[model samples]
Target: MSLEAYIWCAALKLDVCNGTPFRVLLCLADRADSLGYGAYPHVSTMAEQLGCSDRTVQRAIRDLTAAGLIREGDQRYVQHLDSRYRPTVYDVLTTALVTLESRGDNRVTPNRSRGDKKRHPGVTSAVALRTVQEPTYQDSSRELTLVTAQEVEEDQ
Candidate 1:
């Protein structure tokens, strides 16, 4: 779906709450689209539409970047809008995630079992916690603690 449409649908379906900015963004972005513009908004423009200050827009941009929903690049990124890129960002991201998960590295994938594991050499069980301790309760009140190599060094 178009970014603007996606945002609008999400905002409307979610009913503001945390979606107000995205709703505003979608509205402004749609307006920009109608103007025959591929305008990558400066924070001020975004803020004006969202009825927020520039800082708020900036924060949203930063959050989007951190979440990998948006990215920055030199002129090349703009020239090849990710929306137009073959093997779009979403495809590449999901493929990469799948690759890692098949190798038993991603924490978010399920359907992993011994048969699946045998397919990949050197893959460890995802459920296996590489912890150093076996829990031993000191008293009725159980307090969990991770044993570390440091304690051995201190003893020596």
Candidate 2:
């Protein structure tokens, strides 16, 4: 279970009068990974966990999909003895969070536009830059010598 996904799901402000869709979303988020993927529980499993019928769980899933909260993922086939059922996976879309943040009510407005005014003036200077000095050693005496860029260019 991914705590991050669950927290994000809990933070979502759904506009539903009934709580079934929100509960189902929380269940999916509980099974999702850190990236909000890999929630593939069976419909019956979710129904049992939520104390609701399979049809109710299915409807909740449909509602979430319609609301752009969760999306259906790839189906996995079972290869058990005489069993050939494909289970549907679900992925909690983080895009929903971005959409929520971009909404008119939730959007953050800047205090002022960039074209209004400048708080600080730009800095400009007309100073001449100097070349770095390099040190050289000769023999074991370890004498320190400083060489400037002009001297090195002249030698070259």
Candidate 3:
């Protein structure tokens, strides 16, 4: 587990994530390898670590999976003389962190317009102002360019 990865996970927006799911995500991030592969831990163990019920942990796993932040990986089944069990491996999608970092300046803000029927009532939206400037790179030597969501949509 990289300290930088854990820090990145901790800095995610809480408005879009419930407490349990966010804690579960942090736990997985703590065990992730350089490639974002996390070792499978028993549900009971995870529950203990997160200080929650096993059912809560299960729900968190479901939420993370549904949100596309984590994906099920390989499974290992252990067969004993009288019992069998399979442990689920997970791959945390680190690309989500990159996307989030790139959109750090863009956050959900309340839309006070009365005629904005395209948006739900009392709901907030993240709308980045369009710009025609060239993409900015954090590292000039690496040639890594940050593209906004609107830019990707425009390209498509």
Model 1 vs. true fold: TM: 0.33
lDDT of candidate 3 over 58-115, digit per residue (tens): 9999999998878885442222222344557776667644466478743232222455
Model 3: residues >4 Å from true position, as ranges? Answer: 76-85, 96-156
The top-ranked prediction according to lDDT is 2
TM-score of each: 0.33, 0.54, 0.52
Ranking by TM-score: 2, 3, 1
**Which 10-residue window in model 3 sums to the lowest lDDT?**
74-83
Cα lDDT tens digits, model 2, 68-155, are 8888753332222234444577878765444554674342222323443434323222222224444555435857699999999999
Candidate 1 residue-wise lDDT, 19-71, digit = tens: 54454345334533221123254456657767888777666655544544334
**After best superposition, candidate 2 residue 47: deviation in angstroms?**
0.5
Better of 1 and 2 by lDDT: 2
Model 2, runs deviating above 4 Å: 16-18, 76-85, 95-156
Instruction: List per-prediction Cα lDDT, in the order shown.
Output: 0.43, 0.71, 0.68
Residue pairs of candidate 1 with colliding backbone atoms: none
